[model samples]
Target: MTLAARAPVPGRFRRPRALRSERRTLHSWLMLPVEAVARLMTITWNPVDAFFEAVFWRDAKRPGKPFHGGWNSMAGRLARAVVPRTRNGAHVVMQVTGHHLRLAYVSSARTLTGAPGAVELGWYTDLRDVTWIRDRSDVVGGNHEIGFVDGSWCSVHFVGDGWSRMPDAFPLRLSHLDAIPTAR
Candidate 1:
């Protein structure tokens, strides 16, 4: 048989299609900007950097534990705004001081700052109760649900925040990407 062109036939492999399971939903799309801003903030000010400097006996801006906190979810945002919740459970930012957890929030994007984690503020509580509930369904560890001492909880699906310097920041929380699992 004669061929129109004197070139060998190419492989019949078709272009890979976007997996149906990998499709993005409206919610995911909406969260894109929020996630970007979270990451940007981390780049602007990496709390972990200062943490390590202090650990090595280097002079730091604030001589204390590194900042530990992520953006709250929509629900957390509301509770953070509420006086009761803000005092007890809604913390977008926190610092582990000598005997208590100092919670703080930025002036903007207070509702959803970064990956969410909730801690119920109480008169007698320490970092021992800093709870963490990994999202087993999420193999990538992008989602984590913070369990409250009172049995309430909230989930956050953020990529992660840049707030962890050591492998095990008391409370045993995940770094999302920074923390690597040990191979047993």
Candidate 2:
């Protein structure tokens, strides 16, 4: 006797549509409070950080120490108060150039890992990278995110209005950078 061939059943290996939709809805509801808290922090703390940066840390040139005085001092306490607690737990410098995205941090004795200065560079051409840039505002400071091809992403949030430039720094040329195609 010959056996009859049968087609594979649909939705056998995947979750049901209704269940998937319900999970998505639950996830969105859970994330609403988190997003709200982040926005609240941005609105309240950004101005405070900006004021301290403009008045107290204006002339400071040190790389590791951003505050004018030591961490125990009043200026330092006020400065530190505005810094948002983040996932990485490190103060990082993020720069996006034409060819690469760079993340550098100065690690001191206070750091949890106790690692020293470290630098990480990822070339855009090597990965499918997407960047999200948020413009600075009076209440909220500017922030950026870089999504890599490996499904990993990094975000950087500024403590103050980053538009202000020091006299020695070169002028930002937005027009030239905008002309280049960023697609992978």
* Each candidate's clash count: 2, 0
Off by over 4 Å in 1: 1-91, 109-126, 133-142, 157-167, 170-184
Q: Given candidate 2, what's the lDDT at residue 169?
A: 26
RMSD of each: 22.4, 22.5
Candidate 2's residue-wise lDDT over 67-105, tens digit each? 123433322222232232222223444344555433333
Q: For model 1, what is the error of residue 62's alpha carbon versus the real structure, in angstroms, after optimal superposition? A: 41
TM-score of each candidate structure, all chains considered together: 0.28, 0.26
Residue 163's C-alpha lDDT in candidate 2? 33
Report the backbone clash tally of model 2.
Answer: 0
lDDT of 1 at 181: 29
Model 2, residue pairs in steric clash: none
Cα lDDT of model 1 by residue, 1-184, tens digit = 0101211222222111112222343555677798789978867266787677758645344332111222242223222322221211222343456554433432212234563333332222354444543332233233344333333333433223643221234455554343322212
